[model samples]
Target: MSLHMTGAGALEDPICTYPGSRLPVRAPCARLEGRYLAFLGGSETFGRFVATPFPALLDRRLGQTCVNLGSINAGLDAVLGDAGAMRIAAAAALTVVQLPDAQNLTNGFYRVHPRRNDRFLAACAPLTELYPEVDFTEFHFTRHLLIALHRHCPGRFATLRTELQRIWVTRMHRLLRGLGGRGLLLWLHDGDDSPRSDAPLGSEPLLVSRTMVDRVLRQARGLVEVPVTAAGQLEGETRKMDFGPLQRPTAEHMLGPAMHARIADRLGDAIATLQ
Candidate 1:
């Protein structure tokens, strides 16, 4: 596949694709040679605004090749459905699978875009029936659709939440099993000490909870929970992120260099034990 550069962050992050899949991942990609670590997740794992994501930092720290397969706004569908990404992860020395939000996936109630999991394609029959009063046509993204649904009726939203969570667990299990026991579940949340059961709408990893994580915990090598600490949420560090003028707001919401360094530090230790 051809290599191209796109300005998703401060630098011109190179976009590359694998042989069997068209999924765009960050480049300077680890060649399929000797032992390497693989990372799979959404924007955080992709390191949207930061110059060096945790995977790259670990690459330098551990002196090992680390292939970052993280895609922007990736869900289980985007990760598991990619033959190319999965092939790399399964063969890696270890794979870090980021816990994606339950909302950005296809469930019984709605269908999301196959690759861009955050894009809402269409509502399933069940969803329409449940929200007959809602006009799903107005929605373009999963987060907006979900927020509207909850506002329209929190009671009905509960039912939808349950289903999303249920399917998230099922799909996550499938992902870990596919890794052949080399997967490590990564729970990367910002601005909170722990994942809450009643986490607000639009929260990253939407509708996922500690209990949900535990359900799939034992299936992988282990779980790495990195909660962006109270101090980490400050505005000072976020200023270090590289981005164009329009991307500043987004950069502020994303993890900055310090947090990425911290994640690299934590992951390096964990990966060392396994190596």
Candidate 2:
């Protein structure tokens, strides 16, 4: 079946503008000051449905300068390619790298895409005419593809996943180290499976399992997990979200605003706890 869900409206908010196809970053002076706390991730981190994202909330709570380097449809390469982001990271007192779901794929480095932001090119310059094919839409499709391919052709997918994961981990290590070993690397995932048995062999597990969680943790210096489905603040609420009409599962069913709020709260707490 197609992973694309039908019938949900794109959540509308002031935060959803693209400078080119790349998501825009709030001006540094307006949002950051002193030692930096940079948030890196995809749409969720960009605060698609909510008005104030977690990084912004964290800034308000701590009264410290924080930058939201998040982008809609952002993959790993986007993070590595933003020069302003890198400069901010290199200067931050605390850096929080919020990893997105592994379904997102990015080549080891960032390349200039007509749809991408100029900041990316400003960050990393290269003389290469070739670019790899990667999908920048639909998480489910990407995940399903990976799972199906892995299950049907184990060797290739396994090798690809291993290499990608390693590259992700290593790049992260370098980013953190470059920040002077004083940042927290936190992975934010929607609970979706257990580590071993949850492989995309045939079924979709509703929640992330301990084993898979541990594996993600193992890849980081420190970790924090927040489940949108189970966060206390969102236990019961009537507020609804619209995920655009073209998406399936509807907006209310897909991602509730309460979930985003809880994520923000959790991220805030995580940032506060960092040494």
Candidate 3:
């Protein structure tokens, strides 16, 4: 499939597809070449709107080939299940795994699309049995379905949130194990990690807390998290970003140059220990 990684430019980006990976990655991946770094995550990792995403910034900073293995709205299932993506990540000198929303993963409660984790597929018998009054077919995206469910019945949604958190923790461990010694877990969010009971836990990264992320690291200090500043949120130019009219709103919400720079700095510092 032809993936649009950039807008029409005077100098077109060399983004292309390589064997084994479903999503188009920043080209010249150098999968078989010298010491390289692998960055895996959702659209933010892909540098959706910013001229330089964190991986690209890190590549220039470290003077290494940092392969962009970003998948749109991706979760553990897509990366872990794909042999080619895992192959490149495992082979890399270091791999940075971005923590996606807790709601995107496939769990006992509900199943997301295999390739598009954001797409809500079908609720399992248990979820349906839990909310027989709700029509699962009424939703397409995971967030939408979850919001409606939460509003309709907060009591039942709590159970689902707990399950998602439990699954996220377990699956994260499994993902780290698969990536081996080079893998570093990254949590890139827009705000603080302070826990709030009323925060929509079923939304993007719904119930995940600082403690949970710390649990994944286990005091290893391998995790690199960067919360964007309020000013940084407004930093972006349409000229640097790529998207259609329908997607303009979403592209606006992506990380801008300032945030990318911050993330890259933290990533550079964190990856130094890996070397």
Best by TM-score: 1
Q: lDDT scores for all predictions?
A: 0.82, 0.51, 0.75
Per-model TM values vs. the true structure: 0.90, 0.64, 0.86
Per-candidate RMSD, Å: 3.3, 8.5, 3.7
RMSD over all Cα atoms, model 2: 8.5
Superposition error at 9 for model 3 (Å): 16
Candidate 1 structure quality by residue, lDDT tens digits, 1-275: 23233465334545678778778887656688998889998878888767788999998999888999988877899988888889888999899998898999898999999888999999999999999999999999999898888878889998998899899999999999999999988887764535344644544567887788899988989888777642236758866666666566666777788778888888888888877
Write the residue-wise lDDT of candidate 2 on 1-275 in tens digits. 01233344343434432232234653232434456676766566665544456777777777776777777656555666665566666676766666544334343333223223222231112212121233323223445545544555565555555544565555555656666665565555445444555555321221223444354454444666676652223444324432445432333333356666676677677666665
- Residues 4-95, candidate 3: write the lDDT tens digits: 53353223334566687776565545556887888888767877645667888888899899889886677778887788888888888788
Candidate of highest lDDT: 1
Q: 1 or 3, which is superior by lDDT?
A: 1
Clashing residue pairs, backbone N/CA/C < 3 A, model 3? 201-206
Model 3 clashing-pair count = 1
TM-score head-to-head 2 vs 3, winner: 3
- Which parts of model 1 are misplaced by more than 4 Å? 1-13, 191-199, 229-233
